[model samples]
Target chain A: MTFALLARCGRTGRIGLAIASEDLCTGAVFAHALRSNTGGSVTLGGSPGRNNTLACNLLAQGYAPARVLQELRANDPQCESRQIAVIDRHGRVAAHTGEALTRSALHRIEPGFAVLAGAAVKPSLVEALVQSFTASAALELDERLLKALESAAAECATPPRSVGIVAFGNQDYSDVDLRVDLHGDAIRELRRTYDEYQPFAAYYLERGKHPRQAIPQREFADMLYAGRSGNTR
Target chain B: MTYSIVARCPRTGRFGVGTATFSIACGRRNESVRANVGISKSQAFYDRATDPLVLNLLAQGYTPQYALGVLEAQDPDFQYRQLGIIDRAGTIGVHTGRDIGPWAGHAIGPQCVAFGNGLAGPQVVEGILGGFMAEPDAALEDRLLRAIEGGRDAGGQASNGQPRPERSAWLCVVDRGEHPLLDLRVDLHDRAVSQLRRVFEACDRGHLRVDTR
Candidate 1:
């Protein structure tokens, strides 16, 4: 299973995740993003529930980086089987990858950002994604995240037949937002979906997609969660 | 350059020619041949005047060997060029021009055949033939890949010295038991090919994998 996701929450935060696995329907297991006052975690190849709880708890306690990871390690039995990256509302970041990962897997943590990628990935992909963020001029954080995923996909000599990416951010209650998921030739399809929906830059964003009324969270969620084939666009 | 092609009409069991050389647009030339029943002389190959006409005569039920015999009776200098075909009933025929490139040849079989030119030697054709013969169950796409790979390994196009990284390549297979288009060209380099493939696959998935209702 391979998946790519991008989400933006008001101006408070941005998050991205890409995970590939030979297992069918792996997307339903890995790739979890949750953001609240405390912080958020972009967890891949790990327990979705435990990871989500730890992230929510850390944010609740105002914990950041190493402190949150240390607490997570203390509680989890198979810490090495998980790959987790977290960034809070304050731009603090931390990541961890268990030593039990296959030889083909690894993680990288840097200032204010981290990349946890593996499963038949070239070593250069991680570094390229991280470096491109600083050098590329993306209008939004989500854009940068998508570009990073594209770079990773293109770096492979023989790219895996499947690839995916995910990005999410916490938005203030008043800010406009969107969430997108896509698969297949990850970069091409992702860009296509972005252009077709024009979600981030939609004129309706400021108006909240309503001419004379404010769209409630439940209504927007209903619209966002409706799953239709990309062809429906 | 020399090349060959064979395909069966989906509605009728009629097999036809679908390959050409001289430039990259063999797809176009193959179309013209499809209207008629057999191989045609290269527009520029002057000496071989009525090769296509001969093949059409054979399509009327003459033996491939007899068909080539008739063409030989007309043009004694036929071996100087290259053309080949296998009709619907396992009938086979081939022609090689003396003026054609060195070491060009072909071998026909019940279901397929191998042909090539500008190769290291006749063994290149042999290698392609062997590859097709070895993989009986492979889809035509895979068989084409094996044949092309075999030709490449056997010194494809004699002048291809240093590996001139191919800008593009194509693979196609037409068999009677399935759709006329089994697997269309997958030009990994062309944005159009991948983009079109994505759209088609998405449509296919939408129709076959998901609940339309």
Candidate 2:
């Protein structure tokens, strides 16, 4: 089982998700699709399929959060065993946890946030996500998402084998996207990976949009430098 | 930048080193193993000459300490290099340069010496030592992996307060051919340990490349 959050920052027009599980390479299975700054979807658990497009269309049709859930519930026959959550560009949040969920399964929905867990997680993790996300106002979206995962894991007193973070900022691409395939300490690994990717995030974004003028001439000289294989003295 | 353990099984005669670092391709930079002779981890502001020098000294049938001492005597800035080694006979030695980074030290155990520099705390070395000392009967590869895991858990190398996952991790074992039975490396990965483990698991199965040379 797994736990995840699909969120949109009202102030920044960004959307993202933070997820963790006992699985390997969670990104491959869980990340349905993202529509740049429009929204993102997390499709997971119990024979899940790509429902993110459904969510996007529902949002575009101007359905409220409750109506979005009701529409999705009526459309899919296998919806009972699935867990899906979403945040539209306008920051409306909604989620669905199947009635078949075990007692441990839990989920929460706020105005601009949704935290949902599969059968393997306790309800307390949802609380941890909310509290940590609220407390981490000063951090970047990626770091805030990570803090939420750390908080949930800490409260549960057991970390997952794999953790993934995916965020969409002003650009159509993810500003910070990473995965800890498996580790004894996935949170620390995730944090390290995020830090490494952070320095290159904006450079790559600018490079994508304005390939010629994006990077400084001096810095780009160093950037294009290739390192040799072994120590040379 | 890192710490490591180079050891012999004493039973199977297999030799190996388990190491982690903030630097890239640490195995290629710091560790050198001469088949049936010995293994060494020379690191932290690493000097390129150390790997060959250690291998040459071991080839000449020198003890770990005398060999390192002779190597240090030839180098003017010997105080900056950190090293730990074990010979075929299981003779062990460790050296930390006086001018090396803070939290640098070594802990000697039977058949192995675990040492680290720029570590988070003293426990980093202790954990490597304790893990190696425990389960003495396990395969050398398993034991080495365990030691590195312990080292990370206790606090692996870092200039800051809490130790973070390293940028690279390496594990290598040599058979009688002096060729690596397994030489798996996570040269620069966020989940270095985990990636190395996956590579190790694949190499451990009959899925290994036997160096022909």
Highest DockQ: which candidate? 2
Instruction: Tell me the whole-model lDDT of each prediction, alpha carbons only.
Output: 0.46, 0.69
Candidate 1 local lDDT, residue A3: 24
Error of 2 at B127 (Å): 41
Write model 2 residue lDDT over B111-131, tens digit each, in one string.
Answer: 888888888878999999887
Interface alpha-carbon RMSD, every candidate: 25.4, 16.0
Model 1 segments beyond 4 Å from truth? A1-32, A157-183, A199-209, A212-233, B1-213
Instruction: Estimate the overall C-alpha local distance difference test score of candidate 1.
Output: 0.46
Worst 10 residues of 1 chain B by lDDT: B204-213
- Give TM-scores for every candidate, taking all chains together and pairing residue i with residue i: 0.41, 0.49
Clashing pairs in 2: none
Q: What docking grade does candidate 2 earn?
A: incorrect
How do the candidates score on chain B by TM-score? 0.62, 0.91
